[model samples]
Structures are given as structure tokens and as C-alpha cells.
Target: MTTKRREACPNLEANLEACNCSYEPCGRKGLCCQCVAYHRRAGQLPACFFTEAAEQTYDRSFDRFIQTWS
Candidate 1:
């Protein structure tokens, strides 16, 4: 079987420098699939989950994500 290639988000790729996701454990810094999977497994979104300032704080916790959205 052949392995499927992952797709990268052009928009995100162009804006990675501005992205604030601080969870370094993520393998997909600009890749949407890998990022989504990583967050899903951890029950959280990537650094892009919060504003630039908030993301800079490096708090990728589920509660923080909810607090931001709320």
C-alpha cells in the first residue's frame, strides 16, 4: 500500500511566522492535517487556537482554549 501525502495549508504556511501555537511537540507547524490530529488526540487545538499574544504564552490547554472562545 502506498502512503498518502499530507496536505499543507497555503494560508497557514504563509502565516506561520505570525502563528502563536507554542506546543513544540506538534509535528505540523504549518501542516493542517498533522496539526489537527495532534490537537485532536490531546483534546486541544494548535497554537493558532488563541490570539498571537495568548499563543505566545504557550498555554495550549483545553480549558484555556475554551476560555479564549468564551
Candidate 2:
């Protein structure tokens, strides 16, 4: 896959401030676009969709997201 280099995002700082993903060392931590794309390809949702307590579970599944929100 010849992916283009990600441009420096303007919202990086803000995204980082709000991101709740508990998986440390994630390259996509503050990159919402990449994070969402990555999880979507894996048939999952990003941690931001869940509550703080729920995000800690690291499930990231659609069922988990729905269960957490609904």
C-alpha cells in the first residue's frame, strides 16, 4: 500500500486533549482521521465513541460501542 505521508494536522493538539484511547504507543493516538480509518478497516470504532470507563476495556468492537452508548 503506497500510502501518502500524513500532513501535519491543525487539530492535533485539540485532538490529543480529547482523545481517551488507553492503548499506549499508538501512532494514531492524536490523529483522528487515521484512527477512525484504522478502526473502520478492522470492523471497529475508535475509543472516543465510548465512555471513559468503557474505553478502558479496549474492546473497540461495534457491539461494544453500541452497548456503551445505547
TM-score of each: 0.58, 0.83
Considering only N, C-alpha and C atoms within 3 Å, which residue pairs clash in candidate 2?
none
Q: RMSD for each model, in Å, please?
A: 5.4, 4.6
Sliding window of 10 residues with minimal summed lDDT for model 1: 1-10
Off by over 4 Å in 1: 1-26
The per-model lDDT (C-alpha) reads 0.67, 0.84
TM-score of model 1 relative to the true fold? 0.58
How do the residues 2-52 of candidate 1 rate in per-residue lDDT, one tens digit apiece? 122223454564555665666675556656667778778988767777887
Give the per-residue lDDT digits (tens) of candidate 2, residues 11-57: 77788889988998788877899999999999999999988999999
- Most accurate candidate by TM-score: 2
Task: Evaluate residue 37 in candidate 2 and report its C-alpha lDDT on the 0 to 100 scale.
Answer: 98
Which parts of model 2 are misplaced by more than 4 Å? 1-7
